[model samples]
Target: MSTVTNQAVGKVTRTRGSRAWRPYLYHIIVGLLSLLMIYPILWMAASSLKPNSEIFTQAYTLIPSKLEWNNYVSGWKGIGGISFATYYKNSFIIVIFATIGSVLSSALVAYGFARIKFFGSAFWFGCVMMTLMLPHDVTIIPQYIMFAKLQWLSSFKPLIVPFFFGVPFFIFLIMQFIRTIPHELDEAAKMDGCSKYGIFFRIILPLIVPALVTATIFSFYWRWEDFFNAVLYLNKAQMYPVSLALKMFLDGESISNWGGMFAMATLSLVPVILVFLIFQKYIVEGISTSGLKG
Candidate 1:
């Protein structure tokens, strides 16, 4: 019996040892991948701090030999033509309105699809799904012409208003998430004398916080990074977003301010990073819960 006990103890010890080593192996793999992902960002930050001369130098140093913080200062002032502050404001305004509009409109439309059964519901849903199959590039010219005819050119209206109508992808995502919730809850609410709007506002909205966060984060990121449309429709420099303003830093005629340009590029990425970090937990939870239900 003592020998058998010892044998069992030995097996348990081996299992414990394996478990400890497995985590270390995972850590090493993750560390390597993290370094791979972070290296470019580190290189960009280092280059931003270096003088124009040091950027192309043979030195493999991550730390700049001569740090010029003025690159950031000058970058903020922008090139000869524009100001980064104005661009920042423009981008912020567009992102705020677009994010709110997209989230609210998508949630409402999603609720309609998920909860209500009306005539041609499946057909309309199919149409919405088909929109996802069509590329935005394919519809850009028609959208641009429509906007131009409506005299929305050179304004933030084009960027902001479309979101209020609901984006197809976000609508689909939210609809899936809503469907994951049991219909019994809605029935119970209705039995308790709650109206459909009341059920939506009080119960459904609270439950789908994760989906809303995910949608908001996505919308904000897209609006912030939207340069193609900004360039296409916006003629006035004052109306350009940070995305377009960043391009002005590159002067192909003579010498581009590589340090300043990189500094601005790094700065440009901060809002996106912050927004992601803020809602990352909700985004993950929302997707996970939505998958389990549907």
Candidate 2:
């Protein structure tokens, strides 16, 4: 009986010990994968500090033989006498206005779809949802012609104006989030003599802060990194955003300033990283809860 009891205790101990190492093993694997994913970004940062001649020569090395801070200074000086500061200013102007427009318009439209009932509402909602399946590439030509006809080409209007109508993806995301809120709250606000706009502004808007923040972050990222639209609509070098300005480093007719390009590329990532770190929590909470019921 004593021997049997000892054997059973040893078996339980072995089983518990085996399960404990699994978590550690899982963490190690995940850590390796994360490192692999971020290695390119880390390498680029290191390369920015390397001598221009050594960048491609020692491409595999993450450490520079000697730091070259001049790369950043040269990059900031920019092309055609336009400084990086101008590019940054242009980028901020487009991103801020477009992000605000996207978030506010999306929220208002989403509220109507989720809470208010009107004639042909379901049909209109279906049309909005169907747009998610449509690619922006399909409509680019038509949009370009329309903007051209209005003489809005080569201007910021083409970049920022469309966002005022709301983004299809964000509209759906906010609509789903709004649907999760209890209707009783809206009814109660109405009983207190709250107007429709008051219910939206005072009650619904405040409750959906997480979703709004999520939309804002996404809109900021999209607008900040918009290269295709910038290149398509912007003709003047002085009017270029950072995304388009970066391309000026490449001189097809002469040697390209790759080191300067890499340096500015590293700097451009700062705002994006800061935004993500600041609002990451809301992104997770908003996405997870937005789908809870609707």
Candidate 3:
């Protein structure tokens, strides 16, 4: 019996040792793939530290012989002497309001869909979901014409006003999460003489924090990266956000500053990266919980 057990233990040990290398190999492959995907961003950042003349010449090189720290200075000053600070300010203002509007409005709409009993609620919720499958390009021309008629052209109104209406994905994400929350809480609030508004403010809202943070992150990221709408509506350089302002670096001619553009581009990603790092846990929780309901 002892000899048989020893043989069995040796076989199990051999199997474990063989499988141990599989996880390491998997990690190695994943690491390589991740590096491959992010290599371009790394190269662009490295090139930002090089002189403008050396950008294309040293494109393949990951390191630079000379660190041209002045790229950041030149980029910040920008064209027309307005400075990138103005653009950064513009972006922050738009993102802050739009994010707030989107998350708040989405919560209200999602609450109605998830909890409130009303006539035609199903139809309205269906209509809202329909918009999810609708391509944004399909409505852009009509929206442009409408906004043009409203005299919202060349202003931030076109960008910020739309967010006051709930975003479809945000509504869906939040509604799903709200459904997972026990309805008993709302009833308990009502038993305590809580009104509908009271229940929302005192009970439901507190429970849906993860979903709200998720919506906020998505809203801020989309608004921060919104170059097309910004360019289309904002003709004046003074009103340009960071996304549009980045375009000023490239003139499609001999005058474009490649080094400065790369430097500014790298800087522009800082806020988004920080936000993600801060709220990554909430974002994951929101997504996971929202999925669990349906």
Candidate 4:
């Protein structure tokens, strides 16, 4: 019996080892793929340290022979009229307002959809989903015309105000997350004489911090990187966001400044990368646990 038990245990261990090896193989492949994806970004950072002459030299080296730290200082000063400081301030203002507006509006709308049962609730929910299916390109002209009529052109209002109305994708994401919270909690709050607003502020909001964080991160990134709308609406160079300001580095009529461009691009990515790293845990948790309806 002991000999038989020992043989069975050995076989089980062998099976477990094989299954573990399968995951390890996949992990190794994924690591290599990640490295491939990151190589371009790494190359860009390295190239930022190189001088203009070394950028396109025949004996192109990944490592710069002489680091030009002043490139960052010069890039921050920007080309002639526009300054990076102004663009950075513009980006910060837009991103902050937009992120706050998107998160708050989406959460409120999502709560209504997830918990409230009223006349035409289903129809409105369908409308929200339908809006998601429609491409933004199709509506851009109409939106532009509307904003133009309002005289919101060449200002941050175009970027900021629309976010106060709930975003369809964020609405859907938060609704799904809100639905996962047990209805019993709502009932319990009501039993304690809590009003709907009270329950939402006290009970629901705390539970959904991860989702809010995720939405905030997305909003910040989108608003920060937005270029097309900025170009379409903003005519003043000083009013431009960093994304639009970066275009000033191009000569348009002549060759572009590749080294300065790369340096600025690298600098632009730092804030985004830092924000993601800081809130990545919340994002992962929000995505993973948001589907479990309990």
Candidate 5:
């Protein structure tokens, strides 16, 4: 009996030992995968500090033999007479206005859909959902013609104005989030003489802050990186965003400023990284909770 008990205890110890090593193996695999994914970004940042001559020669190296801080200085000076500061300003303006417009309009529309039932509400919501299937390429030509007729080309109006009408994705995200909230709160607020607008502003808005933040992050990232629209509409060098200006670093007639471009490219990533790091928690919470209705 003692021999059998000892054998059982040995078997349990072996199982426990195996389980303890599994997490370390999983962690190592994950760490290697993460490093692989981030390798290009790490390389870009490292290359930005290297001299133009050594950038290609030592392509695989993550450490610079000599730091070329002048790459940042020259990149900031920009192509032609315009500074990168102007490009940054232009990008920020478009992103900020677009983010604000999309977030507020989407939330309001979502509130209406989630709480207030009206005639043709289902049909209209279905139409909004259908818009998600329509590609931007299909509408660009007509939109361009319309904007041109309004004399809105070569300005930020075309980029900013369209977003004020509520993005379908954000509307859907916030709507799902709003549905998770108890309807009893809306009823209670109504009993206190709160209007539809009041319920939206006072109750719904505050509760869906996570979804709103997630939407805002998405909007900011999209508008900041909008290259195709900016290229189509913006003509002036002064009006170019960072996304468009990055292309200027390559001159067909001249040697491309590889070092400078890499430096600016690294710098451009800062805002996106910062925004994600700060609001990443909201994104996870918003997505996870939005689907689970109370």
Candidate 6:
């Protein structure tokens, strides 16, 4: 009996040792992968502090011999007359309004599809969903022609206006979220002498806050990074956003301000990082919960 007991104790000890090593192994693997993913960003930051010539010389190394703080100052001044602040202001103005327009319009449209029973409602909703599968590039030419006819080209109007109509993907996302919400709430609100608009404002609006935030985050990020539309619609350098201004740093792939570009590029990521950190919880929860319901 003593021999059996010793054998059992030995097996338990072995199992404990194996289990203890698993967590450390997992952590090491994850840490390595995390470093791999962020390595480019780290390199960019280090290079931003490097001298222009040293960027190529020390391309493989993340550390520079001497840190060049002036890269940030020069990058901020940018090329020619306008400054980086002008690009930042333009981006913020477009992003804020576009985010609001997309979230609000998508919510309203989604509510109509989810709650209101109107003629041809199903068909219209189907059309909206179909747009999700449609490629955006297909609409560019037609949209540009229409904007040109309206004399809306070479301005922010082209970028900001379509968001007011509702982004198809966001409309679908919000609609799915609204479907999960119990119709009983709407019914109860109606019984309490609440009109359709009142139900939307008081009940649905508050409940779908997470979904709306998800849409807002996505919309803001996309618009802030949008280069295609900005380049197509905006002709004047003064009206250019950070997306285009960054392009100006390169002169036909020959002479480039490598240090300054890296510096500005790092600065450009700040807003996106801050936003994601702030709303990350809601983003995860919203995307997960607002799906596969009624």
Candidate 5: tens digits of C-alpha lDDT, residues 178-275: 99999999999999999999999999899999999999999999998999999999999899999999999999998999999999999999999999
Can you write out model 1's per-residue Cα lDDT over 166-269, one digit (the tens) per residue? 99988988998999888999999999999989999989999999989988888888898998989998898888899998788777798888888889889989
What CA RMSD would candidate 3 show?
A: 1.6
After superposition of all CA atoms, the RMSD between model 2 and the true structure is 1.1
Which scores higher on lDDT, 5 or 6?
5
Query: Per-residue lDDT tens digits of candidate 2, residues 153-207?
Result: 8899999999999898999899899989999999999999998899999999999
TM-score of predicted model 3?
0.96
lDDT of each: 0.89, 0.94, 0.93, 0.88, 0.95, 0.92
Best by lDDT: 5
lDDT of 3 by residue, 1-294 (tens): 999999999999999999999999999999999999999889988988999888988788989989999999999998788999999999999999999999999999999899999999999999999999999889999999999999999999999999999999999999999999999999999999999889888988999999999999999999999998998888999999999999899997667988889999999999999999999999999999999976
Model 1 steric clash pairs: none
* Comparison by lDDT, 2 against 3, better one: 2
Give the CA lDDT, 0 to 100, for residue 45 in model 4: 90
Candidate 1 local distance difference test against the native: 0.89
TM-score for candidate 4, please give it.
Answer: 0.89
- How do the residues 1-294 of candidate 4 rate in per-residue lDDT, one tens digit apiece? 999999999999999999989988999999999998998898889878888788778234578889988778778878776678888899899999999999999999999989988999989999989987898799899999999999999899998999999998888878889988889999999999999999899999999999899888888899899999899889998898889988988897987777777889998998899999999998888877666763
Scored by lDDT, model 2 comes in at 0.94
All candidates' TM-scores? 0.90, 0.97, 0.96, 0.89, 0.97, 0.95
Best by TM-score: 2
lDDT for residue 67 in candidate 6, whole number 0-100 = 90
Which 10-residue window of candidate 1 scores lowest in summed lDDT?
285-294
**Which is better, 2 or 5, measured by lDDT?**
5
lDDT for predicted candidate 5 compared with the true structure: 0.95
